[model samples]
Target: MAPPLDTRSPSGPAVSTLGRSVRQAGIEDIPAVARITQEGPLRTDLDPESAARSTRLLLTHIAFERGALWVEDGVDGRIARAVAVVPGGQHSPWETVGRVVAPDLARVPPGPDADQAFRTELAAVAPRWVLSEISQGSRARPGPPTLLEAALSWARAEPGWRHGPIAVVADTDAERKAAESLGFAERWTGGPPSPWWLGVDTDPVAPGQA
Candidate 1:
């Protein structure tokens, strides 16, 4: 198993970002992960069936791919936040789920733009790193920086960290803004009918820069 995520740099510059307690999740954690994600910040137009299907696909992939699923503990002794980390080269849960249906247009309220972004930006990425299934529980927000640090920790440990890019799929406006503040570039933007897929990319050298 991979080591727990910590604030360590890829190269010489030491990452002093205080670490958090992260434990590798087992089969038992699947239900909690699923429940939290079901209540996550997904599109409002999304029906319960679609939501359940999406969650199922995402969690299944996380377990099957041996990807990293970090569940942070809340002050109330419940799940705070949960995120699924997958290598850039591998198939992101969003990618798989998207194959079944589009994001923005699927439900109408939030059409298929999110799915489009995943197909274009994430699917076309060159073996880098991906952050998906980012959800927070009823507990206090962990702040975007901490979530971002968890992402970087995975990259810092990647063998190709030096030359690789990082991508994140944000499901809502808030998530998108946090990524933008972190220097992540938007992947797509156009006129009507295209839907707004908030795909973000960060530079390999700076990691935080677009």
Candidate 2:
């Protein structure tokens, strides 16, 4: 299992000179973050309850994990955007419920019990590590450049970290163009017209970036 992350960097949470401040998210921020995700090209193929439950669980896992969930707070004190850079390892809470379909995600009860159930589920899986990617909230609110910069900064500071490819799912022409602009190439297509795009790195660490 990977050690817990140090969310408080020496440079702080990479706050921009502008009014917007990018910082690690807390449990309190999940609601706003989830709402922000709805404004994005997120998948909605599942039933509303399942979709909402999965999103909530994801945000909970990342936020409580401390370093993965990044949120850009607007001058109004509301969350303008959110991003998550999930580091792969056996201990990652994301592995518990991420990528799961409706019934699995929906079966988990809400609130604190959900966390316990997720942990129990995680314990059943064998330990393994894989490369994950930086994910952002609504493209409508703010593009990922700044938030991604902050996320990468945190990631690079982690022990044994390495530069690597980024993966994203684009559901619209605009999103596809944006991904292409950032050097991501289409890797595969999936649910709801979303195509996976991968930004390859020439000098990634051996085995994987994680």
Against the unseen true structure, what C-alpha lDDT does each candidate score? 0.50, 0.45
User: Highest TM-score, which number?
Assistant: 1
> Model 2, 101-207: lDDT tens per residue?
11122332234544444344334332221122223412453344555445545555665554334333333344455545444455543332222322322233333
- Winner by lDDT: 1
TM-score of each predicted structure versus truth: 0.60, 0.53
Query: lDDT per residue, candidate 1, 1-210, as tens digits?
Result: 243223321112222223444443444555666666555355666676777766656564543244555555555545555555565554453554332222322333333664455456556655355664445422333254555555546555656555556666555456556667666787754345443344555545443443
**Candidate 1, run of 10 with poorest lDDT:** 8-17
Cα misplacement distance, residue 82 of candidate 1 (Å): 1.1
lDDT comparing candidate 1 with the true structure: 0.50
Off by over 4 Å in 2: 1-14, 39-47, 62-67, 89-144, 163-192, 202-210
